[model samples]
Target chain A: MAERRRSEATRQAILDAALELAGEVGYAKLSVEGIAARAGAGKQTIYRWWPSKGAVLLDALLAYTTGPSGRIDDVELPDTGDLSADLKAVLRATVEELNDPRLSAPMRALSTEILADPVLAADYADRLETPVRELKLRRLRRAVDAGEVSADADLDVVVDLLWGPLRTRWLYREGPLTKRYTDRVVDTVLNGIRRW
Target chain B: MAERRRSEATRQAILDAALELAGEVGYAKLSVEGIAARAGAGKQTIYRWWPSKGAVLLDALLAYTTGPSGRIDDVELPDTGDLSADLKAVLRATVEELNDPRLSAPMRALSTEILADPVLAADYADRLETPVRELKLRRLRRAVDAGEVSADADLDVVVDLLWGPLRTRWLYREGPLTKRYTDRVVDTVLNGIRRW
Candidate 1:
């Protein structure tokens, strides 16, 4: 039990170091050697745990977002029972989070890392994205059961239609990330779901 | 006239060299010096012509997609008057383009480059994304005029609803980039536009 606890502390140190250096030098210049040095851990320690620097970066982001419990599935998507209001509130919060200056650099760096490596990207999707998406799907499914949304509506498509524009604007710099934008996305996609 | 012709040729050479080096070394290792060496132009010439390696990479992609005419606005979205069919066909073609193996490496590298630099991303939006979106918006407006789509639909939101999901799928590797996926996206967003 003590061994497991020590290992967990080391892992946290490595992830914290990875995030710090990735932000400082950006992902391209981020190195396993540098992360090891910063964490005061052996280089082989990181290699033993992660196949590449991008994988380490991914873990860092997952850890940061999930907090101490690392309970990623503990999503708190508001289900005020008014599906539209719930959606607007959640997406508005997302917009604010994305726009936060503190997160921007690390998020952009993480995106670059994800884009550069497919294996790491898959790990990201499985561990981080899938859990969050499932939680969201549950929320939408509840709405479907309530008859607020069409039974025939593809919940997957509905989720993407609402959130995908924000992804584009964030990654591609297509436009400003704003509450107004997310609100429009929610309303427009709700049109597809509620009626179609 | 002689100076202008030579300068244009030099610009093309630099861009060509940038693309080759970026493909070989990836954008992280791509450099003005390396591009200059390959193009047989001085580093000063490259620096004079482009702000950064990312800027040169952006230009190479634009030039490749736009052809030698450098006309970024020549979008050829099919308008067969069956708005749904037109959209499905075009989105299917897009899926094929994105799936092309020859384009994948460079496209990934370009995405990393864009994500790394905000100025470069803004340039990409102006030079590539905006023109294509305008062409798409025009097609949607045409449908609105034909009474096929609701006049009240925020066409920008409609456009994003269809295309943005694919962007998420592609960039995040969230799902298989398939004709089936694009078709579903097209139909789902069409439901919003046509009915709501």
Candidate 2:
């Protein structure tokens, strides 16, 4: 029991160190050695848990956003019965997250790292993307139950339509991710999905 | 006159070499020195013509897709009188471009490079994204003139809604870029934007 507790503590320290170093130097320049030094843990401890700097950073990001006790599966969309308001709020938060200076560098690095490696991309999809997508689907289903959307509506496509613009703006840096933009997106999409 | 022709020829050779090298070694590993060596041009020559490897690749890709005389502005969407058919045909071609092995790596690299650098991102938006966007907007305006779409429709938002899904899937590697998917996107978006 004591050994298990110590192991868990070490793991948390490593993740915290990784996040700190990632924010400091950015992901491309972040190294395991730097993380180990910051955490006051040995190199062996890091290697024994995570394979690479990217993997460590991914885990750190997940932990940071989801909280210590939370898993990626625990991510939830708002369900205030007003679909437009709920979606705008969620997307606004997303825009904030995307635009956050400390988070943006690591996020960009994460994307580049994922693009460069197939294994990392698959892992990210499985661990992060799938869970977030499922949560959004669940919220949309609730909206359907509330009569905010049609029961026959293709939720998957709707989800893509809702998410695609924000993702494009964030990834491509094509436009400002303002609250007004999110509101417009939600309004336009709801016009299509809402029952007449 | 001879000197100008020779300089243009050297520029073309460097671009070809850069494209060829980017494909062989992947973009992350590609270097100006390697490109200069392969093209049999001095590093100074490459520097005089293009700013970065990403810039060279971007130019090379434009040249590849548009042919020798074609500029980025020359890219046009189809106008088949039926909005659905025209959008799908253009999107299908886009899907093909995204899925092409020869183009995918360089494209991904270009995205990463653009995301990392504000200057490159602005340049990409100006040189590539703006033209494509303008062309699509022009097509939508034509649809409006034909009474297929409502005149009051927010063409810019409509454009984002149409392009977002494809951009998201290609950039994030979230799902397959299939013909059926493109058709579905067009159908759903048109339902929102078209005149009732």
Candidate 3:
């Protein structure tokens, strides 16, 4: 138990150091040596636990967001039975998370770097995107099952269409990602785009 | 006129060569020397005409998309004034342009690189994003003026909301950017998400 505690503490230190360094230097310049020195752990410790710097950072991000719970464990779409309210609640939390100063730069840089290197992108998708996507899809499917969604609706399109505006707002930084905007987005996707 | 023709030819050659090499080697590997060699022009010719590689590529992308009319001159967003149809039409063209083999890979690499590097990112916004965004805004404004859209609506939000899905689709290779998808987006934005 003592050895396990030491190992866990060392792991957290590495992740904290990596997150700080990734934010400071951007992911391209983040190095294992620098991370090790910053964390006060041996370089071999990091290598033993994580396969790559990307993995370390990914794990860090997961831990940072999830708190004591493992990634994807505690987070769930609001299930108040009203889809709009539920979606807005979830998206509002996301807006806060995206704008969180602790997370904003490193996450953006990591995502940006992944885009440049296609190989890392797959890992990024698996580690980050897929879980979130699956969670959202599951919630939307529940809505569909409950008849909150149109019977003929395509869940995949529903997913893209649901998140598309929010994605645009965050990625482009072109407009405010206010609750009002999320509300409108939720409203627009649920109803058809045609005029009554 | 003869001397002017010579200058124009040289400019065209430089741009053509830059685009070709950007595609061939990826943006990071492309250089002024490669562009000059491919264009059969002197290095001084490139240096005299353009300030940087980003500028050269931007001009090339503009020319490729808009021809000699310049980036904003063509104004393809039809004022035929049926806002939904007009929006759909322009988006359909954009989908084709984005999917075109000639434009996809290098453009992706450049966008990816800019995401990581702040300096390159500013250039990208200046050379590509600003002009395009301005044009889209104008098109939306014209629609508002013509009574096709809500006069009091937050036009900026609308523009971001409209393009957000399409951009995500293209950038992430999320799904087929077909006419159907484009039409659905146009419909979604014009109408609200709420069920009547």
Candidate 4:
């Protein structure tokens, strides 16, 4: 029990240090050596726990958003039985999270890092993208099962449809992702873009 | 006219070489030296023409896409008076261009470059994003004017919504973007995500 506790503590310390440094210097500058020194752990500790810096950073971010007790499993669109309301509530929360200065810098940096470095990119996709996408897909499937969405709706494209606009906005910093906008997206996507 | 012709030829050669090298070695490996060598032009010629690597690459890409037509000035979304077909036709053409092997690699590399490098990111936004956005916005406004879409619909976000899913699929290299998916996105954004 004591060894397990110590291991967990070391793991958290490494993640915390990685997140802080990734935020400060950007993901391009994030190094295992730096993270170890900051976390006061041996470099081997980070290597043992995570395969790469991106993996460490992904875990740190997942931990930051979902918290220790909270899992991605808990991060679902509420089935409050109204699809629109549920989607709006979730998206509004996402708007807040995406806009948060504290989170955005690190996340963007991490994204940039993965894009620039193929090794990090692969690790990020496996550790981060898969889980996030899976969770989102699961939530969307639930919406379909509840007969809230069009039976003919392709969930994969639908997921991209939901995420793509938000990504374009977030990536380019083009405009605001307002509650009004999220509501509009939910409305437009459900109804159809045509004037029928 | 002879001097003018020589200058134009040199510029096109440089751009062609840049595109070729960017595809072969990846964007990070591409440089003025490489492009000049590939084009059989002097390094000074490249410097005399463009300010930065990012600038040169994007110009090369723009030239490749637009061909000898110069800028797409007279280009307007076909207002065939049938809004859905017009939008889908434009979008399908865009989808084809995005998926084209010649364009996709450099475009992806450039996007990756922008994500990693802030300076390049701004350059990309200015060179590529702004014009494309304006073009799309004008097209959407035309649809509104023709009474195909509600005037009150948020045009900017609507445009993003329409293109965003395809982009997400494109960026992630997730799935094949077929006409079926394209039509679905159009229908979804036109209507709404809800089942009535």
TM-score, every prediction:
0.81, 0.89, 0.88, 0.92
Chain A, candidate 2, TM-score of 0.90
| Candidate 2 lDDT | 0.82
Q: What is the Cα-based TM-score of model 3?
A: 0.88
B1-196, model 4: which lDDT tens digit per residue?
Answer: 9999998898989988888888788887988899999988999989987887777888888777666764755456677877778778877887887877677778877877777667877876776677877888888888888788887777877888888888767776656877777887777677666666
DockQ of each: 0.38, 0.39, 0.45, 0.66
Candidate 2, residue B104: Cα displacement in angstroms equals 2.3
Residue range B80-128, candidate 3, lDDT tens digits: 7688888888888888877875787667756665565567667667767
Residue pairs with backbone atoms closer than 3 Å in model 2 (clashes): none
How far is A129's C-alpha from truth in model 1 (Å)? Answer: 1.6
The residue-by-residue lDDT of candidate 2 on B1-196, one tens digit each, is: 9999998888889888887888788877999999999999999988887888888988887788788864967667789898889999988988998898678767777777787778878878888788878999999999888888877677788789888888888887888989888888887777642123
Q: Which candidate has the highest lDDT of all?
A: 2
- Candidate 1 residue pairs in clash (backbone atoms < 3 Å): none
Cα-lDDT of candidate 4: 0.78
| DockQ category of candidate 3 | acceptable
lDDT of 2 by residue, A40-77 (tens): 89999899888888889889888878998649776678
Q: Name the best candidate (by TM-score).
A: 4
Of the candidates numbered 1 and 4, which has the greater lDDT value? 1
**lDDT string, candidate 4, A99-185, tens digits:** 886778778877766666677767666766777788777877787888887777777767777778887788767678788888887
Better of 1 and 2 by lDDT: 2
Candidate 2, residue A191: CA error in Å?
A: 2.0
Return the lDDT, model 3, position B69. Answer: 65
lDDT of candidate 1 over A78-180, digit per residue (tens) = 8888888999998888788688745666677777667767787788788888898988899988888787887777788888888888987787767788888
Pairs with backbone N, CA or C atoms under 3 Å apart (clashes), candidate 3:
A187-B193, A187-B194, A188-B193, A193-B187
TM-score of chain A of each: 0.88, 0.90, 0.90, 0.87
